[model samples]
Target: MMKTILLIVTNIEQYASGHLKTGLWLSELTHIYHAAKEKGWKITIASPKGGNTPIDPESLKPLVLDGISKSYYENPVFMNELAQTKSLDMVKNDSFDCIYLAGGHATMYDFPDNTTLQEILRDQYESNKMVAAICHGVGGLLNVRLSDGEYMIKGKAVTGFDWFEETLARRKNEVPFNLEAALKERNVHYRKAFIPMTSNVVVDGSLITGQNPFSSKEMAKVVVSELEKQAFM
Candidate 1:
């Protein structure tokens, strides 16, 4: 059977300022999508609201957009997934081998409070299935509590977009809260790339996370490797 991945994307199109545009970080999704695609895995893109997810304009810049992400941007079929995302409720009963949360500044605004997202994550996590997130998408993991009422990431080693990176991005003050601090408060052994803006991934059991956009490819590779390992077991 083909392995399945449920990719959760954010629906928010802009930051709270309303002037600075923000949405899904293209590479964050494309990198993982292509990696899983290479393994012949089935991928489904869904969101909190069900339709029309936006792409962050910053991610499309020449300096930031990689060839792989650009290719997906140009591919009509792949882009269409963002145009018609299934709502969280739509996939509540679906089973997937892994659940990945793609990131962007927009995720900081919407990913944390969605009860539906929390429920889905709780289900996937407590079931011992793989759960992964990158950059600001880690926000989605913030509020996910297990059936025992403990935060899923509590005491687990994880990594995500850190405060320094947010400061470097010049959106430190614009963001609603400090993600690194939030993770720490949840009792997670939070980690990040020493040099910043580098590929950093942390896997603690079934939960996997990446520190930033640069970490997506490696994160996806880890997910695939773990799944493949289990396949032969």
Candidate 2:
């Protein structure tokens, strides 16, 4: 039987700041999705509101988009998936072996405060299914509360789009909110790359988090590794 991966992304097309376009980070999804596909895992891309997920324009820049991401960029079939993402409500929590949140400035806006997404994360997580996110994608984990009425991240060591990293990228203000502060608000034990924008992936049991966009591919490898281990047991 094929394993299933639920790759969640943001549907928000742009930021309120204007002029700066935002959506899903192309490489974030491509790196992981392609890996899962090669393993013959069934990949279902979902979004909060669903339908026509947008891609961050900056992620497509010549400096960034290349290799697997560049290939996905030019493929019409892959492009169609962005326009055909299933809504969060359409997903059956029990069907997926893992749920991954993709990042972009768009995720910073929509990932948090979504009741449906929160429910899915909470249910799947409590059931021992794997959950992962990267960059601003970590925003989705900050607000997930457990059945015990405590924040899921309360004691978990995690990391994501850091305020300092955002500053280094010179897009701190462009981001919707201070994700670092929000995670701390729930008493989340947070950490970051020793060097800014470094590829950092933290594994705390079933939950995995990445420090920045650069961490996406490695993060995917970690998830695949975990899946491989689970297959043996």
Candidate 3:
């Protein structure tokens, strides 16, 4: 039987001061979606608000576009899946073998501090399911707590779009808060590439994370590898 995965994206548009537009980064979803499809896993998209999640226009630039995401944009069926995404409230725990959070500036505004999302991560972690996030999407992990009342990410080695990447993108001032600073404040062992915007994926047990949009493909490969190992075991 093919495994099922739930991928979450943000519905927020403007990140800060309504200057920097935000939505799900198409590359983040496409790389993982295609990788999972090739490995025979079914994927579903969900959002905190649900319905008609938008894509960041910047992410759709020819230089950033991947073949899978470009194709996904043209496929009516796939577009409909994104158009009618399930709300976080409607999802049940333990239904998916893996849960991935895709990133864009919007995630910083909506993905973090969501109670429903926190519960989903808690349940997924407790069930030993693979939990992954990339770029700003790692913001979603900020509030997740384990059943024992400890932070799910406490002391874990993880990576996400770094503060330097934000600076490179020239949105350092527009972002509400510094994600790297926030994670470090919580005692999370956050890692990053030496250079900004490089592809870096980190896997620590059941938790997997990628540094930026450039890292999503590697992130997905790592997750699928873990899932395959678990399935055989």
lDDT of each: 0.92, 0.88, 0.88
Q: What tens digits encode model 3's per-residue C-alpha lDDT throughout 1-233? A: 58999999988877668766778898998888888888778888899988978899889999888787899888898888888998998885449999999999889988889999999999999888889999999999988989889889999998888888888888888888899998887788889998788799988999999989899778888888888888887
lDDT per residue for candidate 1 within 3-69, as digits (tens), equals: 9999999899987888798999999999889998988889999999989899999999998899999
lDDT of 2: 0.88
Q: What is the lDDT of residue 18 in candidate 2?
A: 86
Candidate 2 weakest ten by summed lDDT: 88-97
Model 2, residue pairs in steric clash: none
TM-score of each: 0.98, 0.96, 0.96
Off by over 4 Å in 2: none
Clashing pairs in 1: none
RMSD of each: 0.8, 1.2, 1.2
Q: Against the true structure, whose lDDT is highest?
A: 1
Error of 2 at 53 (Å): 0.8
- Looking at model 2, residue 162 earns an lDDT score of 85
